[model samples]
Target chain A: MPGTRGRRADARRNATAILDAAVECLSRDPDASVADIAQAAGVGRVTLYGHFASREELLDAVFARAMREADAALDSLDLEGDPRQAMVLLIRSSWRIVDRSRALLVAAERGLPHGRIRELHQRPLHRIERLIERGREQGEFRTDMPVAWLSAAFYGVLHTTADEITAGRLDEADAPGALTGILLAAFTPPGQPVPTAD
Target chain B: MPGTRGRRADARRNATAILDAAVECLSRDPDASVADIAQAAGVGRVTLYGHFASREELLDAVFARAMREADAALDSLDLEGDPRQAMVLLIRSSWRIVDRSRALLVAAERGLPHGRIRELHQRPLHRIERLIERGREQGEFRTDMPVAWLSAAFYGVLHTTADEITAGRLDEADAPGALTGILLAAFTPPGQPVPTAD
Candidate 1:
């Protein structure tokens, strides 16, 4: 157990260092070479390969790290407030990730393994679903529509809002309130109380 | 006016021919060369230049044709039966355009003189706004949300659904219904009657 413990700790350290280097390289240039990443990580080519078999695996790891950070943010997000306000906060937080990891997203768009990421990406979405479900049960969200559809619509707005922010068409500060108002209007059940703006 | 009439007829024919060739070429390959387009249209490069001036202008014509087609589809679309069903039909028609002219969309995404095309793109969106406004006024759509965000959300879903279709993750036939359900849920006014699925 002692030897196994030491090996696990060492592996974690190397993985962290490699991911950090990958993030830096991708931020500067999405098409950064593996050799450059290894150099930055102060690890040899073989060591880097040992952790990630291919460039795609390395990129996937980098993407997963960003997603993990996003999930961590979700962990601390307060969803107990009025569902509409809560959703707005969640979306705004998600936008911060998209903004900071712009290069990673660009790379993913060019051609990253999507199947692997879809499940990881669905984590935040599942949380949104729960909130929508809560709103529905509380008579705040319309009961006629399925949660699946609401989730898709939520994702749709998030995508467009992110695009607007990236393209400098809309100020980031205004996106949360704007998107929240729209979602609230779209999702609020009839006769339910509307949440006051934050 | 006899000589003037002949000249006008010839100009109209040439413009129509240019637009037809542009649609064919852009749909097949958005990045197709101008020389190729001229050859396909049976016109000299100089004549093509006389008509369109630049690649951006030609793309603008291509997008205009697509938008016109979309607008025409809206006229024929039967959104009268049920709001949700009608919305689904509209989304389906839009998806067909995306499928048929994916190459052109890729070109648009790459960079089409955003100024005029962007304005033209908003034309259909403005029309959608009117539809949504009508729905809200009629108590079919939620009244509290800005139509602009809902419109953007619709466009975003269209883009993503198209992307999924292009990538083969989602079948084209299933997309409309799936997307329609989500949009209807998002847009239905609180306390308003929800349509039962057929």
Candidate 2:
């Protein structure tokens, strides 16, 4: 039992290495094989199997890693700017993450069950909700709407922008600016009341 | 050559029938097959091939049909209500199109070359642009921002909402009302000048 525990620990380490290597290789080449990932991780076939029983498991691990990385990015982001600016930053950051992990995203899209990735999205939604409340209090955003609706719109903008960029209809350089403009136009408060020149 | 040309005309009819059947069938069942489509359309194997030559070709035709249907919806849509109401209608109508042709959409997402379907989107963009101009001219919408940005945001909300409904995250019935509130909140003018409560 003592020796078995030690082997399990070693096996876990090898699995992590293989998963990291798979994430890297898959990001570069979606069709990268398990052998290539094992080679990249400097692990033997037996070691790789000791960790992941099959290629599908290895790919799933890589996808989970990418999701965790994206989650960490969201968690560590500083959203201290004006509410509108903060929203823009969040969307842009999300696009960057999606772009960086496009291959894995495509794999997740095709292979994983629908809505699995979305379960990891609640934290980002809560953060954005706070920013929306602050913007409303600051008189910069509309106060009459529900936070859930705003959250949906925020997500909509992010997902649609990512799709546009992925489809090559939207230029990557212009995505952030364009999306910012859209969000601002939607959320910005009304200006000075101009009396009608009758 | 004359005989061949006559045969080709009949082939074109059969191909169109096959594509229509495929779109209808696929809209209901994404896994629908070539044989199913051919049977539904009452087309013989030889006739189906004389037009499509492959399942991918039939899929391409179906995607093209869906895009064309979307454009037709835009063209025929009455933009007569309050600008906000008109915009809401536009979103709802677009969502309905996607819902009705979800099978075709799934095929388009998987099989059609990316960006091809979006090209059919420009007509709706222009319509929304004109509507935004009307709202601004009526002093209901913001004048400082570009209409293009507003147009894109409108599409973004619709696309995102449709996707959520497809993925079963957002309730299908809630999409219209929720999106309308978000769009209106985002676009509505800020505070009217009044004495400060504080």
Tens-digit lDDT track of model 2 for A9-67: 88787877888788888767777787898899999988888778888677777777776
Model 2 CA lDDT for position A176: 63
* Candidate 2 colliding pairs: A186-B186, A190-B190
Which parts of model 2 have CA positions greater than 4 angstroms off? A1-10, A29-60, A76-114, A117-123, A126-149, A166-181, A184-198, B1-6, B43-50, B77-89, B110-116, B119-153, B184-198
Instruction: Give per-residue lDDT, candidate 1, residue B102.
Output: 66
Worst 10 residues of 1 chain A by lDDT: A189-198
TM-score value, chain A, candidate 2: 0.74
Worst 10 residues of 1 chain B by lDDT: B189-198
Candidate 2 per-residue lDDT, tens place, B50-104, comes to: 6787887778777776677788877798888688677667767776776666556
Q: Per-residue lDDT tens digits of candidate 1, residues A41-114? A: 98998989999998888998888778888888887988996876676777677767776777677565443643
> Alpha-carbon error at B11 in model 2, in Å?
2.0
